[model samples]
Target: MISMQIRRLTMLLFVFVFAGCASQKSIVADKRLEEKIDQNFSDAAAQYKGMMRRLPADRFPKTYYAQTDKFQTGASSDWCSGFYPGTLLYLYEQTKDQSLLLESERILKVLEKEKNNKTTHDLGFMMYCSFGNAERIQPKPAFKDILLTSARSLASRFNPKVGCIKSWDKVKSYHGGEWSYPVIIDNMMNLELLFYASKVTGDSSFRNMAISHARKTAQNHVRPDYSSYHVVNYDPETGAVKSRETHQGFSDNSTWSRGEAWGIYGFTMVYRESGEKSFLKTAEGMADFFLAHLPKDTIPDWDFNVNQSGYTPQWKYDPSKFAEIPKDASAAAVAASALIELSQYTNKKQSKKYLKAAEDILWALSSPKYKAATGENGNFILKHSTGSVPAYSEIDVPLTYADYYFVEAMKRYKELKK
Candidate 1:
C-alpha cells in the first residue's frame, strides 16, 4: 500500500508538472456550487495526501487493514473504489492536480487486482471504482484490458435463470432459507460494469442482464413507498421473487438506511444510462420516499424502521434487540450525490428539491457531530457510521466512503454551478 501511495504521489507530481501548461481560467461561475466543489475537492485531496504522508517508510504485506497507521481504519476500502477514484477524478478535472491523478492511478491498480479476484459480492463496488471510472476519467488503450477483463468478469456473474447477479457468496455459509439467490441493492452500482461490457463487447446479453436485474429489483425489492429491502430472495433456477429480506439492518421487514440510499442512487443511474422512463420514475419515487422520511437536515438513522422510539414489541423488534440502533451519515452522503446527479438530468422542480435534500445532508455531515477533526482516530470526514448491522460494528466511526461521497456530492454541486 505504501508503494502504491508512493507511486501515486510520484505520478501526481508528474501530472502537476505536465498540467502546469493547461489554462486555469474560471471554468465555473455559480458561487455556491463553486465554493462547495472547492471545499470538497480540497478536503478530498488533503485526506489523500494525509494518507500518503502518514505512511511508514518500511513496507508491509498489504492486508486490508495493514496500513492502519497511515489511513483511516474504518471500512477504508470496502465501498471506496467508486468514491475514492471518482473524487480523485473530480479533483483532477477541477485543479488538474497531478498528485491526485497519480493517486487515482495507484488506487486503480489496487482496484484492478480486486476486480480479478471475483470471489466477493460487490462487483459494482470493486469494478466500478477501478475500471469503470478509469474508462471515463483516464481512458487509455493500456487500461482497456483491465477494464474489459473486469467487465467480463462482472457480466459472467449474471445468472440468466435469476436475471440478476448473485451477491453474498462469501456468506453462503450463513444459515438462511432457500430464497437467498438474487440481486442486492449494492448490485445497482455494479450494473454499470455490465452496461460498459455490453458496449465494449457488443453483446446485448450483458445489457439485457443488467436491465433484467434492475427491473426485477424494481418490481420485488422496492416497496410501493419506494423504500427498498436489502435483499430479494429468488428461485435460483427460475428467477422468481420469493421474498424480501434485510440482512444488515434491524430486521428483514425494516429498511436499512444504506439500502434505501443505494436504491435512490442506483435506480437514478439506471435512468441516466439506459434512458428508460421507468428507471427515472422509479429513481424519483425512491428519492421522494427517502427524502420524505429523512430528518430535517436530511441525515437518517441507520435503519429507517428501527423504531427509534423503541416502542415496538420485543418480538417485532427482534433484530435491534441484539444491536444498538445508530445513525449512518455515510448513507446520507451517498444518497445526496445520487440525487445531485438526478437533478442534472431532470429539469423539473422536483429534481431541484432532491438536490436541496442532498445539500442539506452535506450540511449535516459538515457539522461537528458528524464530521471528524484533523489527526483524529477516524480519518474520514463524516462520523457515526455502521459497517455491520448484525454485529453492530463500527458505530460512530469515520468511514472512507463517507468522506468520498461527501467529496463527490460537493464536486457535483460545483460541476452544476452556473
Candidate 2:
C-alpha cells in the first residue's frame, strides 16, 4: 500500500510541473482577442473617415476633447502631425480601405514640406512616420528622396560634443537655447529614421549619429532603477550636463510614463538595428521597470510618481491628485507595441514573459473600458489617454499617436499569434 501511494504521488507531481511549464510558454489570450482586434480595425476605418471629412485642407488632427466636443488640429510642422497620417496608413494596411489611403496621401502632401524644414527637431515625427509607412506600402522613388531629406534634416540636430540629438531649440521652462541644450527621451524614438537613411544610402554618418545618440542617452537619460527622466539639458559647447528635469511630469525626478515608454521602444529598436547586447540589456531593463508598475487593468498613470515618495514636485504637492490619477492608455499602447518587438530579442522564458505582458495590455486597451465606441470620441479609437498632465494639455483625451501605437500593437500581436 505504501509503494502504490508513492507512485500516485509522484505521477501527480509530474503532471503539475508539466502544466506549469505549458502555461508559462503560452501567451495570455482567448477566443475574444481576435474578435476584439477586428472590431477595432473596423471602428478605426469609420472613425478616420469622419475625421478626414472635417480635417482642414492643410491641418492634421491632434486630439479630440469629448467633454468639450472639440477637435484640435495642427499644421504639418506640429510634432504630432505624422501620427495622423501614420495611423491612417496602419488602418489602410489592415483594412485595405481606400478612403484611409486617400486621406493619408492627401495628408502626406501637407506634411511633405517638413522634409526640408530644419528649424525643428521633430522631423522624424513629422516626416518619417508619414513617409516611411508610405514607402513601405507603396515603395515609390519620391518617397525615398523625401525620407532621405528628412533624415538629413534630423541628423542636423545631432551635436558630436554632446553625443546626442538636440531635442529642442527652445524650452522656455529650461531657458531654451541659452542654458538649455535639451535632449529629451523622446528623441530616441526618432533614431529609426536615421537607421533607415543609413541602410538605404550606405551612409555610416547617419548610423553613427544614431548610435552615438543611443549610447549617450543610455548613459545620462536612463536612471539606475531603469526608469527615465523626461528631459536632460546639456551644455552644447562644453559637452557637460546641465540639468535633468521632467517638464511634463508631476515632479522633476518622476518617471513620466510616456517618456519611459519611449525609452522601451527606442532601446528595443536600437538593439534590433545594432545587434548590440548592451542595447538589448538596456531595452530589457526599461521594459522590466514598466512591467513592474502596471496596474491590475494593465494601464498606467501619466507619471509613476503618484504614490511614491522621494519625488519633488515642480508645482505644489497635492495628495488629492493621487486619489484618482488619470490613466495614460497612450503610454500603455506604446509599451505594448514596443514590448512585442523587445520579446523577439530575448530568451524563450523572457520572451514569453514580455509577450504575455504585451498581450494583457492589448487585451485591456481593446476592451470597452478604454476603447471608445465607433463614431464617438470625435472619431478617435482609444480614449482616456493623458498627453501631459503637468502641462495641462490633452488630458483624458483621445490622442492620434495613441491610436497609431494601439493599431500597430494589434497588427504585431496578430502576426505573432499566426
Candidate 3:
C-alpha cells in the first residue's frame, strides 16, 4: 500500500512538469514569430529604398528654401515647412547620411526666426518637426532654448475660453461675419506641442490647455458615427459649440478623407501624451469609422460621398472640367502610420487589423497609379494629394508628409520585432 501511494505521487509530478515545459515552448514560438514578421517588414523597406536612389546633394543647395505656399490663403499653407526636414530625418535613418540631418538643422534655424509669428495656423506642423523631434533626438542647449521659445509662442495662441487653438484667422473677409474663430481638425495634431511643452517646462497650464482642447474637440467635432467635421466653431467667450462645417471636403457636410485621418492620428497622439482613456476611446471610434468606410485596396476618395460620375466642383464659378482628381494617398499614408501606432498602443489583435489596413494602403501607393517616377528633386511616390481648392497647387503631386509617414510606418513595423 505504501509503494502504490508513492507511485501515484510520482505520476502527478511528472504530468505537471510536462505541462510547464509545453507552455514555455509555446511562448518561445510566439516570440520567434513576432521577430520574423519584423524582419520581413524591414527587408521590404530596404527593397523599396533600392528603387529610389540617394538624393543628390549638389542638386538643391543646403540653403535652398521653397516658397511660402499656403494650403488655404487665410490659414498657413506651408505644411511642408517643417515636414521638409522631417523627410530628411527619415532619409538619415535609412541611409545614415549626415548631410540629411545637417539640412534638417538648417531648416530649424530658419523656423527659429519665425517662432514668434502666429499668423500661420500650422505652428504644430511647422514646429513639431523642427523643434519637438529635433530636441528629443539631438538635445543641444541651443535647440532646447529655441524649442522653449517656440512652445511659449504656440501656447499664447490658446484661448482659455474656447479650450482650443484658434485658426483660420478670418471671418470671410473681403466681407465680414462674427469673429468666429474656427478650430480645424488638423489642430489636434499640434496638441503634442503643448503636452511636450508642459513636461519640459513644468507648466501645468499648458498641460491643462491640451486636455481641454482635446475634450472640446471630442465633444464638438466628432459626428454620430465618429466621423468629424473639418471645421468647428466655438464661442470664444463661453466655449460653447456654435457650428460644424467641412472645410476641405466637397461640401459642408461631406466626409473628407484627409481630415478624418487627422482626427484619428491626432486623437491617438492625444491619448499617448495624456494617458486619458477618453482620448483613446475616441481615437478608436474614429479609426473604426475610417476603416469601415474605406473601400477595398484601403485608399479612400477625397470625400466618401463624391461619386466619380456625379462629382461637382466646390465653388459655383469653378469650371467642372477636371472632375476626375486622383485620391489623396498622402493622407492615406499618415492615417496608416497612426493606425499602426494605435494598434500597438492598444493590443495585438486590434493592432493587427490596423497593420493590415496600413499594409494594403502602402501596397496601393507602390503601384504606378498613385506613385510618381524619380526626378532630380522629386523622388516620391503617391501623388494627387489636394491641399486646397482655391490655390489649386500641388493638387496632383507627391507631398512631403506622404513620404514622412511612409518612412515612419516602415520604422514602426521594424521596431515591432525588437
Candidate 4:
C-alpha cells in the first residue's frame, strides 16, 4: 500500500511538471512575437540624425523616391510642410537631442507664416503636427498663439451650407464640371487642431465647428462596410452632397488604403478628444474593416479595390496590364498608431487584439523589408510607402508622414508597455 501511494505521488508530479513546461514555452513564444519597441525607437532616432545631416538645413523633406534615389522637398504652403519639423520634434522627444530641438524651432519660423493662410484646408497638417507637438513637449506661448491662429484660418474654410470644411480649393466634379467646395476623408484629421484651439481659448465656436464637421463626416463619408470615399462634393449653396466619388482610389466604390487609414486615425482621434461614444463606435467599425482587408503581411496595397492580378484604371477602362502594385507603408504606419490609441479605449479582449495587430505592423515596419538601411532610402527611416498612386505621384517611396506615424506608434507602444 505504501509503494502504490508513492507511485501515485510521482505521476501527479510528472503531470504538473509537463504543464509548467508547456506554459513556459507559450510565454517564450509570445515574447518572441512582441515587437521590440525600444529598439525600433533607437533605430529611428539614429536614422533621423542621418536624415538631418543629408537634408539642407533650409529645406524640408517630403518624400524619398527609391527609383530616382532622390529626396523631394515641399514648399512652406504645401500640405506636407509640417512633417519635417514634426518629425524632428518627435525625434527630439525620444532622444532629447539639442540640435534636433533647435532645428525644429528654426523650421517653425518658416511655417509660422501659414497661421493666417486660409486658402488651404491643410493647416492642421501644416501647423498642428509641428507646433502642436512642440507645445506639448515645451509650453511655449508663441506656439499656442500660432495654433490658435491656424485653427481660425482652418475654420474660415468651413461653409455653413456644406456642413463640412472645404478640403480642396478646386476639384473637377464627377460630371466633368467644377466643384467650388469639396470635402475629403482626409479632412477629418484637421479637426483636432480646432478642438485644441477651443480648449485653450475656452471658445465654444471652434469646438462647435469641429463637432459639426465630425457629425457630418460620420454621416456621409463612411460607407456601409466602413470603407470611406475619398472625396464628397457638397452643394456649397444648398448643403447637399453633390457627388460622392474618389479622386485617388481605383474607383468611386473602391477603398483607397491611405484614405481608409486617414478615416481610422481621424475618427479615433476625434473620439479621444471629444469622448463621443458614437465616434468611438464609428472608429471601431472602420478598424474592423481595415483589419479584415489587410494583406497577409499586414501591409496593404495602395488601393484595396483594385484588381490584384493586373493594373487598370476604372475610369479610363483600359485593358488590364500585368504588374505588381506597390504597398503603402504610410497606411500601415497610420493604422498602427491608430490601433494603439484605439486599444486604450476598448474592452480587454479587443484591446489585446488591437495592440497585437499594431505590434505586428510595427515589427514589419522595423524589419529590413520596410526599414531602410543606414544612409540609404535617401536617409529616410522607412521605405515602400505609396502616395497618390492614381495621381502617378510618389509611388513606392519613403514618405515623411510614414516616418512620423511610425515613430509616434513606437512611442505609444513604449508608453503602453510601461
What TM-score number comes out for model 4? 0.91
TM agreement with the true structure for every prediction: 0.80, 0.93, 0.78, 0.91
Return whichever of 3 and 4 wins on TM-score. Answer: 4
lDDT of 3 by residue, 6-25 (tens): 99999999999999998898
Number of clashing pairs per prediction, in order: 5, 0, 2, 0
lDDT of each: 0.68, 0.88, 0.67, 0.85
Q: Tens digit of lDDT per residue, candidate 1, span 65-133?
A: 213543432132354545666556666776787987887776666555655655555666656655566
- Comparing 2 with 4 on TM-score, the higher-scoring candidate is 2
Report the Cα lDDT for residue 407, model 2.
Answer: 92
**Better candidate by TM-score, 1 or 3:** 1
lDDT for each residue of candidate 4 in 1-418, tens digit (9 for 90 to 100): 9999999999999999999999898567446534465566666777777777877766788887767667788778889989888888888887788888988888889889999999999999989999999999998899999999999999999888878889887667545877767899999889999999999999988988888898899899899889888888888999998778888888787889999999988999999988899999889888889999998899999888786554345455332432577799999999999999999998888888898899889888978999987778887889999887655778788999999888888888777766
Cα lDDT, model 4, residue 30: 45
The residue pairs found clashing in candidate 3 are: 70-77, 71-77
Model 3 residue runs over 4 Å out of place are: 1-77, 171-179, 307-314, 317-319, 323-325
